[model samples]
Target: MDEDNWDKLDEEEDEEEGDFSEPETTTSTEPTSNDYMAGAILANGIIWLWLQSLQMFSGFTSRISPSILADFTAVTIVIAGFISSQQVAKRSERNQLIVALRSALYSWAGSLFMMLTSPNASITFSLILLVCLLAGGVLGSYMLIQMRINERKRKLQASS
Candidate 1:
């Protein structure tokens, strides 16, 4: 309130302003739907390339039974979907469901494109893989959102 105090405070502020250390880290950019779509395409490519390599190099032809292969592919798709949803949920606080669906839709399109291009796997299996992806994305996002909401509610109640 006095001139002496005001001058001291101004000097302190000046000293603090000159004390720069390291550069601050910027906030991470949010993941977009295109990222998810690109991820799906990349995953499909990896799967296709890996299978082709096995058949060509390791003699993994019809040795891999259709049922077992299809099952494995379906499981992989579900896990990818779940992981994608988890990433989306972690980065975003709202629009989790919408984002998940949009990502899943793009992922399904990628799968369809892969099947059309290669036609190595069965058509029925592709359909099953698409369903698994959509289901996993939706269910995984829902579960994470619910858990976070419940946790917030509990924290608020405890503090109250």
Candidate 2:
């Protein structure tokens, strides 16, 4: 057969033998609840360590008592993270964002609760928590909005 005909034949054979062995590398480019959980765990852990070091070296274990509530909060954060991560894996970016927002809200609530319930939680520490929560909310909201806008633009472009 001529070179051109030979090439056509090869193409036809390739079409029949499907490339089924190639795994679909599906990934969520968006960060999910599980990501939040991981970050919270890390941050909380660092805080815990810092607290511990201060107590050990400086003898400043003043008002922060290691309580059941603290453990519960940590567990809750992890659980929320897990739920969000699952949503992300299912390609639910909005749900993931919702979970993140909820977590931030909860953090704010927890901070407020701490301030009211514990006399030892200093004003300075409370303000720091508030700042952290505000920053997280702003950043998460911005990301969510951007994702939504981008998706809308893509759909419009595609339809056009």
Candidate 3:
């Protein structure tokens, strides 16, 4: 009887040790609604700051060739969209394309705000910026997600 009790105690100790063994690592990229909202807010803030700076340096912009400025602005918008939406699609490696598209659309609301408020924006320029933002957001997010190097391996996040 004593030997049986001792054996059971040993087994319990082994079970406890096994249960507490090294934490397993898994990718916890499942994005939440807050992630999307955060992306949108980040995008809006970036556009707002960019617009403010452009207004402050209106003279500099005016001196530059309009075509050059337009192209530069398009590129900037795309980059902004990409960066802003990155957080939203960081964990969506399997569905990066769709996530990227949705993230871009959500973040593009800020750009839309800029378009509506711009006193002198031409239709051509606005359309160009729109397309650029779409391309940037989707392309950037997809690339980041597809690249295994950028994947977030979480061991503790799930515990918390």
Candidate 4:
């Protein structure tokens, strides 16, 4: 009876080890939505930069003029925002800053792309996009800071 119990215990331990290993494999292999979004944004930014560089190299000075610098800045900001958002999302923390940053980045990137592709874009459209981006950035940052303060207050109360 003693030998049989030892064998059974060993078998159960092996099964437990297998269960732990399976989760590690599955979690590592599964790509989250944030990962996909970050990849897409990075790819889009790289392609845009590459196209601009090509235009400049081909003597398309108008297409690669001073405005190209602004587009580059927008791309950099958007990519950084996407990366930051992904990191924050992984923490499972709902943050307003991340949400607002994403919103602002998307608006800015889209507006920059539109302006670049259509230099004749209406002034009204440009103004609207800029306003929306600014509003989202301000609102998001403010809300997130408030949330952090609230969380700290709650924690303090609980500890007391």
- Candidate no. 1 TM-score: 0.59
lDDT of 1 by residue, 1-160 (tens): 6999999999999888878656776576456666776656654665466556656754564677778866776676677777665565566667778767666777777877777767466777677767877876787689889889899999999999
- Give TM per candidate: 0.59, 0.37, 0.64, 0.37
What does the lDDT come to for candidate 4? 0.55
| Regions more than 4 Å wrong, model 3 | 1-28, 113-126, 149-160
Clashes of each: 0, 1, 0, 0
- Is 1 or 3 the stronger prediction by TM-score? 3
Off by over 4 Å in 4: 1-99, 111-121
lDDT tens digits, residue span 13-46, model 4: 9999988775444434333556435533553455
Looking at candidate 4, what is the lDDT of residue 9? 100
RMSD of each: 7.1, 11.2, 9.8, 12.0
**Evaluated with TM-score, which candidate comes out highest?**
3
Q: What is the C-alpha lDDT of each candidate?
A: 0.71, 0.53, 0.73, 0.55
In candidate 2, the residue pairs with backbone N, CA or C atoms under 3 Å apart (3 or more residues apart, or in different chains) clash, namely: 34-85
lDDT of 3 by residue, 30-117 (tens): 6766777788778767766776777899988889997886677677778777886666777674676677777777776655676787
Model 2 alpha-carbon drift over 4 Å, by segment: 1-105, 112-120
Q: Write the per-residue lDDT of candidate 2 for residues 23-48, one digit (tens) a residue.
A: 76667555545655554444344444
Better of 1 and 4 by TM-score: 1
Q: Which is superior by lDDT, 1 or 3?
A: 3
